[model samples]
Each structure stands twice: as C-alpha cells, then as structure tokens.
Target: MKAWQLTGFGLDHLVLNDIPKPEPGPDEVLVRVSAVSLNYRDKLLCDGKYNPHLELPITQVADAVGEVVALGTGVTRFRPGDRVVTNYCTRWIDGQPTSKETLYSLGNTLPGALAEFLALTEDALAAAPAYLTDEEAAALPCAALTAWYALVEKGQLHAGQTVLIQGTGGVSLFGLQIAAALGATVIVTSSSDEKLARVKALGATHTINYSRTPNWENEALALTGKQGVDHILEVVGGKNLAQSIEALKPGGQISIIGILDGFDSTIALFSLIKKQAVLRGISVGPRRALEDMLRKFDELKLRPFIDSVYAFNDARAAYDRLEKGAFGKIVIRVRD
Candidate 1:
C-alpha cells in the first residue's frame, strides 16, 4: 500500500512510502479511498504550520470519499461496497460537540485520508450523497460542512436576511450557494475581480473587490441600505473580525472559520459588544450535521464547484495550488 507520510516539516518532507495496509479494528471499516480534497489546513499541515507539535509519519488530508473494502466483525452500520465519506470530526456523531468528541478530529488527532486505505470507526463515516460524485463529495467533509454548520445549524438563517461572505474559496462558495438557495442576499468579497465576477454567476447578489475597496464593510453596509448584514462567514481571522463587526447587524452572528490573517488580533471589544453580536468559532461540524447538509444538497441539486482535480501522485502539486489559492475546492483523485 502506498501512503503519503509527513515524516518531518515542509512539502519536501511529504514522502510517499510503501506502507503495510491497515486492517480494520473490531468496530471499524477499511475504505479504499477514491477521492480527496485539499484544504488550506492541509497546506499548513504540510508546512508544519497547522500544528507545530504534530507527530510525524502520519497520513495527510481529512476530506475524502471512498468505497468500503472490508468491515470489522462488529461493524453493523456498513458493509463491503458501501460508499462513504470521511467525517472531518471522526468522533462527534450528533448534537453539540463534546470536549472528547472534538478532540478526535481526522487529519490531526486521528489518521488522515491521504492514503490508499483508511481504517475508521463506522461512526466516522457518512453515507455519501447519492447525487454527488466522489470528487465532489470529498469536498464536503470540512469546507462545505463548516458553512452549513455556521448558517443552517448555528445561525438559523432564513430568507430576506443578508450574509457577507469573505473570499471565493471552498467554504465561501458553499456559503454563497447555501445562502442563495435559502433565499438570502449574499455579498461576496475577493481580492480578484475575476473571482468576484464568477461568484455573481453562482448566485451572489453583490460582489466587492476588497483590493479596490479596502473598506469592504462600508460596501456591505451600503448594499443593505445601512441596515447591516444578518450574518457573516468570517473566514479571515485576526483584525478582519473588526470589519465583519462593522458589517454585522445588531444581534447578528459571525462564524469564525479560518486563520489566514494570523492568529492574534487586538479588536475593539466595545464594537462587538455595542452591536450585541454573537461570535462563534466554527470547527467543521458533526457527522449528523454533515448528514443534514447532504440532505439539503440533495433536495436543492446543488453541485459543489470544484476548481480542479489532481492525481494522487500529484498531491504535492495540489498542495501547491491550495497555497496559491483556488476559486473552489481542489480535489485529489486518490485512485488512478
């Protein structure tokens, strides 16, 4: 079996080794990975920026979809040939995540998906949406689910509301589609006019080039006639939250999902307080939420936008593409 092992820090260290195939535990299943998607987190993991203390010799990537090759004797949920997708948070099954459940994340605390075979508990698997192809489904586990969790599960968003999305990445595009499908007005911000133009075709009501208009919050406010937006998918961490705060309506919610702009920020606490805004840190989502999102996607016939696909052997190239930024999800075809 061939698997990518992060033996040390950096892309130069992401070595593909001929490793022994893993056998399923009593309650696990062995999945023959068909497709996987690269996230910014995976790039950080490869560069040793995600977790400086992460153990080496572990498989990379977290979002994947595959067919079950074998099942543990005690695995009653699935059997051979059942197509399943990897749940980003492998242990968190339903409802609000517990401390222990949150700790057992895929590609971090547990073995990742960038391998030929992955032995996982049935609880870590979700029935792949029948409508989606393997590559598309592979994009759902983290990027899609995080947007779903923030807007649908936590924010309880509805029609007539406004959502300000930052950037044109995987989660951001998913947010645009989900919000549009639910009848919400979406305002998308990107540094590139080309990407912003693309989002308009994807149902974004308005687009702002942040490079041209650095005070994007003012543009957001103008779009809503000074009423402010009802929700914000704050993918850019750090002081960007302050801009998001400016665009948020009183009592609106901000789901912080990324840390691309460094970790620490000295925000004016008074602004957030005065707005009576709700700030929640989104860490992907639970398996049940993933299932819910799948159901909605099924009903809406929403196809995930995939920017490009790379062969398994070119996984390093996929990481490079991710680091350079992509308009949507970048997929890795795990099976040649």
Candidate 2:
C-alpha cells in the first residue's frame, strides 16, 4: 500500500512511501480510499499549529470517501462494496462532544485517510450520498458538516430567515448553499470581486466586495434595511468579531466557526447586549449530524464546489494550494 506520512511536525517532513495495508479490528472495516479533501486545518497541522501536537509518521486528512473492501468481525451495518464516508469526529459516535470523544480524531490523534487502505469503526461511517462523485463526497465530512451543525442544528434556522456567510471558503460556501436550499436568502462576502461573482451564481442573493468596501458590516446592515441578518456564519474571528456582532438582527445568532485572521479579538460588549445576540462556537459535528447532513444533500441534490483535483501522488501540492486560500475545496483522488 502507498501512504503519505507526516514524519515530523513541519511541512518539509511529509514523506510519501510504501507501507503494509492495515487490518481492521473486530468492529472495524477496511476501506480502500477513493478521495480525500484538504481543509485549512490540514495546513495548520502540517505547520504544527494545532494545540495538541500530532504523532510523527501519522496519515493526515480527516475527511474522505471510500469503498469497503473487507469487514472485521462484529461489523454489521456495512459490508464489502458499500460506499461510505467517515465523520471528522470519529470517536463522537453518539451524543455531544466529551473529553473522551475529543481525545481521538482522524488525521490528528489517529491515522487518517491519506493512504490506499485505512481502518475505521462502523460507528464512525455513513453511507455516502449517491448523487455525489467520490471527490465530492470526500469534501463533506468536515467543512460541510460543520456548516450544517452550526446553521441547522444549533442555529435553528427558519426558511424565511436571512444568512450572512463571511467568505467563500468551504464551510461558508456550504452555508450559502444549505441556507438557500432551506429557503433562506444568502448574503456572501469575498475579498475578490471575481469570487463574489461566482458566489452569486451559486444562489447568494447579494454579494459584498470586502476588498473594496472594508466596512462590510455596514453594507450588510444596509442590505437588510438596517435590521441585520437572522444568522451570520463568522469565520474570521479577531478583527471581524465586532463587525459580525453589528451585522446581526436583534436576537440573531452568530456561529463562530473559524479564526482565519487570528483567534484573539476585541469585542464590544455593549453591542452584543443591546441586540441580545447569541454567539456559538462550533467544532466539526458528531456522526449522527453527518448522517443527517448526507440525507439533506441527497434530498436537495447539493453539489459541492470543488476548486481542483490532484492525483494522490500530488497531495503535497494540494496542501500548498489550500494554504494559498484557494476559492473552493481542494480534492485529492485517492483511487481514481
């Protein structure tokens, strides 16, 4: 089998080499990986930015789609030839996140999908949406599920509500599409006018060129006729927090999902108090949430926007492109 191992804690240490295929545990399944997707977290892991350092020589991608090649004893839900996707939070098989569940995650604390063959528990896997290609299914477990958890699960978004997505990154783009499918109007922002135009084509009712208008919260406010949006999917944390607070309608929700700019930020307490706004932080969601998200994807016929596809051998180049803030999800075809 071929695998890319993170030999050490830096980008320079990723080594592609041959390794023996893994055998499944009694309750596990061996999947022949079809595709793996890159997220911003992959870049941070390569650069040694995650809080808990990953063990050396571990495989590194949390989101993937594969076909089951063999099943170990005690596994019943899945069988050989079943197409499946693993949840990013592989240990959180039931209930909300706990200290125990948080301890083990694919790609970081455990071996991940960047290999020809990988073993995963049956509890952590879901049937991949039949409408999506393997490359598209590979992109959903992390970013798409995070957006679904924030908007649909925690935020309790209604059909007539308006959603404001801060950027065109994977999570925000999924937010745009899901909000639209739920009958909500979507407002999108991007640093590039060209990117903003692309987002508009994908069902964004309004687009803001943040590069030209630095005060995008004001633009958001004006777009909503001074009432502000019902929900704001905030990715940039530090500098943008105050603006996100200002761009919410009274009692509106803001899901803090990323810190692309930086984590530390100054907040205006009075503004949040005045509007009675709710701020929620999200990690990648649980397995049941992933299942629900896949159901929605199938029902809505949602297609993920893939920016580029790299052969499995070009995984390093895929990480480099993700680091450059590419417009959509970067995919690595693992099998075909």
Candidate 3:
C-alpha cells in the first residue's frame, strides 16, 4: 500500500512511500480509498502548529471516501462494496461530546486516510450520499458537517432567518448553501470581490468584501435594516468576535468554528451583555450528526463545491493549494 507519512512536522518531511497494508480489526473495515479531502488543520499538522508532540511517521488526513473491500467480524452495519465516508472524530457518536470521544481524531491522534488503503472502526464510517461523487463525498466529513452542526444542530436555523458567514472557505460555503436551502437569507464576507461574486451565484443574498469594508459588521447590520442578522457562522475568532457580535441581532446565535485570524483576543463583555447574543464553539461534530447531514444531502440533492482535485501522487501540491486559500474543498483522488 502507498501512504504519505509525516516523519516530522513540515511539508518537506511528508514522504510518500510503500508500507504494509493494514488488515481490519475484529470491529473494523478495510477500505480502498478513492478520494481524500484536505482541511486547513492538515496544514497545521504539517507545520507543527496543530500538535507539536504528535507521533512521527503517521498518515495525514481525516476526511475520505472509499469502497469497503472487506468487513471484519462483528461489523454488521457495513459490508463489501459499500461506499463509505469517514468520521473526522472517530469516537464521537451522539449528543454532548466527551473528552474520551474526541481523543483519537484522525490525522492528529491516530493514523488517517492519506493512503491507498485504511482500516477504520465500523463506528467511524457512514454510508456516502449516493448523489455525490467520491471526491465530493470526501469533502463532507469535516467542513460540511461542521457547518451543519453549527447552523442546524446548534443554532436551530430556520426559514426567514438571516445568517452571516465569514469567508469563502469550505465551512462558510457550506453554511451559505445550507442556510439558503433552509430558506434563510445569507450574507457572505470575503476579502476578494471575485470570490464574493462567486458566492452570490451560490445563493448568498448579499456579499461584503471585508477587505474593502473593514467594518463588515456594520455592512451586515445595515443590510438587515439595522436589526442585524439572526445567526452568524463566525469562523474568525479573536478580535473578530467583537465585530460578529456587532453584526448579530439581539439573542441571535454565533457558532464559533475557526481561529484563522489569531487564537486570542480581548473581548469586551459589554457587547455580549448588550446584545444578549449566544456564542457557541463548534468542533467537527459527531457521527450521528454526519449521518443526519448525509440524509439531508441525499434528500435535497445538495452537492459539495469542490474547488480542485489532484491525483494521489500530487498530495503535496494538494496541500499547497489548501495553504494558498481555496474557495471550496480541495480533494485528492486516490484512485479512479
């Protein structure tokens, strides 16, 4: 089997090599990976920013779509020929998360999907949506699920509501599509006008070039006739939260998912108190949530927006594309 192993932190150390193929455990399944998706976290993992102490020589991705070649004993839910997608957090099943459930996150605490073959617990897999191609399904495990969790599960987003999504990244684009599908008006922000125009074609009711208008919050507020948006998918943390609060309607929800701007910031409590806004932090979400989102995808014919695809041999180039900034998910096709 071929896999990209990180013997040390940094893209320079990510080596593609042949290694012994893994066999399924008693409760696992061996999947022949067809496609794998890249997340911003994969870059962090490579640069030693995500976890400096992570063990070396580990496989490097969590989200993937594959065909089950063999099923281990006791795995009744899936069988040979099933096309499945992986759960980013292998142990998070349902409801409130526990530390134990989040311990073995793929590409971080355990070996991941950046290989021709992978053996995963039956619990960590879900039936891929029939409407999606392997590369599109590969994008669902993290970015799509995170958006679903934040908007649908946590925020209880509904029709007629207005939502503010932070950027043109994977999660935000998903947020735009999901919010629009649910009948919500979407306000999208980006640093690029061209990207803003692209998102508008995808159902964004309004778009703001945040770079041109640094106080994008005011633009959001004005767009809503000074009442502010009902929900905000706040990906940029740190000082950005202050502006997100400003863009929120009283009692509106803000699901915090990213810290791309910076990790820490001084937040003024007065804003939260004045607006009575809800700030909820989101991780990738549970397996059950993934299942629920997939059902929605199937019913609605929702397709993930794939910005680009690279062949398996071009894994490093895929990482470079992710690093540069992608309008949607970046994927690597492991096989035809």
Any residue pairs clashing in model 3, and if so which? none
- Residues 229-297, candidate 3: write the lDDT tens digits: 999988889899999998999999999999998988677799889999898888889999999999998
Report every candidate's CA lDDT: 0.90, 0.90, 0.92
The per-residue C-alpha lDDT of model 2 at residue 72 equals 94
The per-residue C-alpha lDDT of model 2 at residue 59 equals 87
Worst 10 residues of 3 by lDDT: 98-107
Q: Extract clashing residue pairs from model 1.
A: none
Model 2's C-alpha root-mean-square deviation from the true structure amounts to: 1.1
**Candidate 2 lDDT, 1-336, residue by residue in tens:** 899888887777888978889999999999999999988888888888873467788888888999999999999999899999988887787676765664577878888899999899998899998889999999999999999999998899889999999999999999998999999989998888889889888899999988898999999999999999999999999989899999999999999998988979899999999999999988878898889889989988999989999999998899888878777799999987
Q: Candidate 2 clashing pairs?
A: none
Per TM-score, the best of the predicted structures is: 3
Q: Which stretches of candidate 2 lie over 4 Å from their true place?
A: none
